[model samples]
Target: MHTLLKNLKVEINDKLYVKDPESSDLGKRILSCSIEMIYELGFEQFTFKKLGLAIKSNESSIYRYFENKHKLLLYLTSWYWSWLEYQLVLQTLTLSVPKDKLNRAVEILTQEVTQDSNFSHIDEVLLNKIIISEYSKSYLTKEVDIENKEGYFAVYKRLVLRLKDMIKEVDPAYAFPASLSSMVIQGALHQHFLKDHFTAITDCNSTTTPTSYFLNLIDQLIISNGKK
Candidate 1:
């Protein structure tokens, strides 16, 4: 993880520190620094000075691209979701059967969570912190609240819609419940991070990979839904 962070820092520095920088390249570099800052320091701890230092630029340069830290955080979150959306779209294109598609989606998502060093450490912590902090502050926005409407929500909604479509395809007689499935999937995928808590509650072995367990649960859900 440290090595990955170091490499990302070097990459950003190279892109932003050129003697003659292209406008397009500089924009990307600042965003990259914002991402790195969010990863290194939790979002709450992230500051413009740190980002500026990371990219070999100034706070004024960053503000030229993003109006404020909130906007930069939004941009970072957008980038994360956009990448996820691309991956999901690619996975969707390759599968014909709905059940198979859902299975593949689950596999792909779990694998991503397990494999992404950045996500495994930084993004996951930031996500949990945001949820907890925002939820407690009475800031939990409705699904379609305009103020809360962002790229992350859009990607999440699209995933749920796709899952709903898959459910309908697999079992047309039953009403497809997306909320349940979405919750299940999130809980499953993040189980690795929550292993200790899960172990305390379920008294299960702490060493098991959550992704494997998640896949098993998804299979059972599909079978159960098929019967209904």
Candidate 2:
């Protein structure tokens, strides 16, 4: 899978950026440094000025790639989802059993992220941490509807739809496949956040992960519903 993904490019909405960050060294540096800075300082405290200082480049240079920190966050989240969809598809492509495919899909979506050497410029693990911690700020705005029409979240929606289809295949009688699919995706992020900060409220811990919890939940819901 790593070999197949070596040359893969995770496409993002061009409208999210003034310039393609992957096109030049400076632009890539902006993305790489911004990820590190955002993870270190959190999104509210992250700024292009801080990113510029971190990368030792002018603030104006960062602007060439992203109009503002909000757009940069959108770009990063979009990239993460697109990259995830690639892995989900490749990893589950050969599974002939619907249940097996669905299980793999859940694991892929909820599993802990590790750094991918294929994309050296971006740290996927840190990006996943950002998604778990700061993703909501990207869309919890008055302009979300406008941005939705502009397709800022198309990749994420498509990923959910892919899982929804798998759920339907697993249990054609299940009436809430789409709802369950979206919940699993969002719930995984929420559970990860809970485990990291509000540990007392969540069952997930060092011994168990969000992936394990969701796998059990899905099997009970889908399989039990199918039995009826």
Candidate 3:
């Protein structure tokens, strides 16, 4: 129920869908129901047919929005990264401190997510879960290069590069800005997965601790490492 932005579009790659899902009511329903069903049933079991039934639309209508489940997955992942890019800018731009901005970036990557009510069809919290669990499937396919060529990976690359800039601001001499930034983002996602599916692999006993752990780790790597 964030009230600041009212129904703004989080643009995804146009090629991921046969038709734009945000352009019409049925398309919107396709998105909303797909997120709901995917979150409930998991990406492996979720299908356009099942999603169509959830929204009381025909399978053909769902197909109009996406080529297959994989495209829908890419569309969802692209949307999430786009949303994250906006949020990172919004949360960090006001700060005058480099470490503070970097710390804000860590929190966004690691902290608990809430459902963003702005996009009524998309549950960001649930979509985040899908990203943590099922995102690899999008790239693990044989068509990954083809998908990349279609702009499926653009938002993710942009997000990582923007965060990489914050790392360089903290330490211009840092040798691995891109590597470090991507590590923090993907590491946090891995921690979430471990905490949920393999508790013994992670020490986060509560929801808030992942944010602390990641921030401290970033401080060690970026802030403290710069001093040495």
| Candidate number with greatest lDDT | 2
Candidate 2 Cα outliers beyond 4 Å, as residue runs: none
Residue pairs with colliding backbones in model 3 are none
Please list the Cα RMSD from the true structure of every candidate, rounded to 1 decimal place: 7.9, 1.3, 2.1
**Model 1: residue 131 alpha-carbon error in angstroms:** 11
lDDT of each: 0.53, 0.94, 0.84
Q: Candidate 3: where are CA atoms >4 Å away?
A: 1-4
Candidate 2 — what's its lDDT?
0.94
Clashes of each: 0, 0, 0
Compared with the true structure, model 3 gives a TM-score of 0.94
> For model 3, how big is the CA root-mean-square deviation?
2.1
Please give, for residues 6-43, the per-residue lDDT of candidate 2 as tens digits.
87998999999999999999988888988999999999
- Best-first order by TM-score: 2, 3, 1
Residue 9 C-alpha lDDT in model 2: 91
**TM-score list, all predictions:** 0.67, 0.97, 0.94
Q: Give the clashing residue pairs of candidate 1, or none.
A: none
- As for TM-score, the candidate ahead, 2 or 3, is 2
Error of 1 at 72 (Å): 2.0
Worst 10 residues of 2 by lDDT: 219-228
